[model samples]
Target: MVEGDPAAPYTDATRARLEVAFAAYELADLARAAVPIGEHELSPDGTGRSAGATLADAAHVLGAARRFFEAAAVFERMAGADWELVGDTLGVSARAARDRFAVAEVCFREGANGPRGETSWWRAHLAEQPLEAARDLDDWVLRHRDGDGDLGTTPVSGGLVRRVNTGG
Candidate 1:
């Protein structure tokens, strides 16, 4: 379990990621519809970095954004959304839906990346395993820790659950 609220980390990240994911999806849909994309140097409030500088960058952005969306959707499904409902929404079988979530759980948690964002940097080089066949959660969590020696975690069901030291 996380030090405080188990769902906090995932929920906080979900909102922002969902926005980006939806935007990416919309952009892709528009492009497929032959809608002309007006050129502009779109930067957030005061961010010096431009959103997309090249075709390759845009492609990468869309791909990365979509994965976040897919991962978030999987997390949502895990939170009491039945496999049949997930299957209907994702257009897959119930078993496949569960499998996808299982794979997502492993992808979302296990890895050498310091955290979620860090994984993006080495996505091409890293190969993630399916959750059912992946390493045990406890082993993975023990292997990955933050700079403060604190490991960021999300609540998972039916496995070795660790009680985080709150240091209260």
Candidate 2:
């Protein structure tokens, strides 16, 4: 009676559940198939809306489903997250997530640089670090404390300074 369709046997609830399964398993898989494998979770999958929902909301579908960390990690990688979806999984405010989004980018870029390239990437990722370091060094030079006070002003703060040699 719903329509002259072949799949009309399914009720609305069934269809909705199917749609959730399709989004998580089918759609997500198709979208990520071409991407190279990496350290992160590639395909986000759930067999039901409750399954498809965030870690915390997953409890509604299955009793053993609330896994906050897993949900956050998956949702975070997504380019955009719907408010309802975020709430279901994270149980956190959409506004909170939006605010943290900017901070997360900083961490993501630094992580991408890998420990081996930390020195070079650190300055680029943190805008304030380079500026502050430059200011301190400049002050040192201007006051004739960097090399030797024989050039200009004498070293007033301290005759010696401690610095780590990062092997630049």
Candidate 3:
């Protein structure tokens, strides 16, 4: 019996299949975005698929694609990806995630199976640090403000504000 690394339970073939599926998902996403809201011919040539496709169908397919990608990513993560790979899959910037994990690295003791104490683990895991300290709010605002001095140009939604035109 051939034993595999516990962290990487998936075979190479399985990983390849996952990669293929991820590509298909990306293509499907592109197609979904290219499709318009109203009914239109599937092909410019008359020999292809019929019209009547709705945005809902595209949305459903996109949702499925997202789920498929997530599943593949889960398998990838299980296949011994380090923290860097994990962060990439999770959509977090590599440097930020790595720097955050660096703290845990410092606290990590070799040969230890896990964190020594619950409180210590929680403290290390949940610690948050600002990427940049805003020493002067006025300076920060002026730096970010556009030439017209309108911070109101872009709208903020879902805690994601669009980047303002910092006339640099």
Candidate 4:
């Protein structure tokens, strides 16, 4: 449980999972903003041209959105969320919801068993520096360059970086 918060009812594990889910939600919001609506004119260099988000850019945003959604689903489940509620929220049947997030759960578990587990890192971050954790998530979402940067180099709080292996 988070310290100095008398109103917080969740255990530490649940809070860590919820933090990850919140981060995923933030990432999803960023991905949504990255989706281009219409064509825009590029700066004139020798020839002025109209350019917008390419098909590949749109596809990458879609893929990132899907991954963020899956992460939210799996983390919420880890935090003791009911499958029926998750299904209702996602507009799917409970079984279908479980099936859809199964891969994410497997990937999370595989990573959790590794030496440098994301789950363990989040837990430690939450326990040691809760406020910094929130700031780190905000920084990550704001500075994230989808498909154009290495995750291992993205700095977070305490001089640590993120390293995601989704097993794709």
Q: Which prediction has the highest lDDT against the true structure?
A: 4
**TM-score, each model?**
0.35, 0.20, 0.29, 0.47
lDDT of prediction 1 = 0.44
Worst 10 residues of 2 by lDDT: 154-163
- Compose the digit string of candidate 1's lDDT tens values, residues 13-130: 3322332333344455444543343345435454425444456555765765556556565556545577788888878898887776565555544533323344443322222321
Q: Write the per-residue lDDT of candidate 2 for residues 1-168, one digit (tens) a residue.
A: 122343223322222222222223323333434344443433455233343334443333342121223234333444355644554555777665445443433443343332223332332422334223333433544643445536433222122122323446
Which regions of candidate 1 deviate over 4 angstroms?
A: 1-54, 109-168
Q: Which order, best to worst by TM-score? A: 4, 1, 3, 2
Task: Give lDDT tens digits, candidate 4, residues 36-155.
Answer: 443443444533253444555667666556655766787777667777878999999988888787666766654442122334456456656655665666476557557755544323
Ranking by lDDT: 4, 1, 3, 2
lDDT of 3 by residue, 8-96 (tens): 23343233233333345444556756566334444556533644445556666775565444434444443456667767866887675
Q: List the residue pairs that clash in candidate 2.
A: 54-89, 55-89
Clashes of each: 0, 2, 0, 1
**lDDT on C-alpha atoms for all candidate structures:** 0.44, 0.35, 0.40, 0.56
Error of 2 at 61 (Å): 28
Tally clashes: model 2: 2
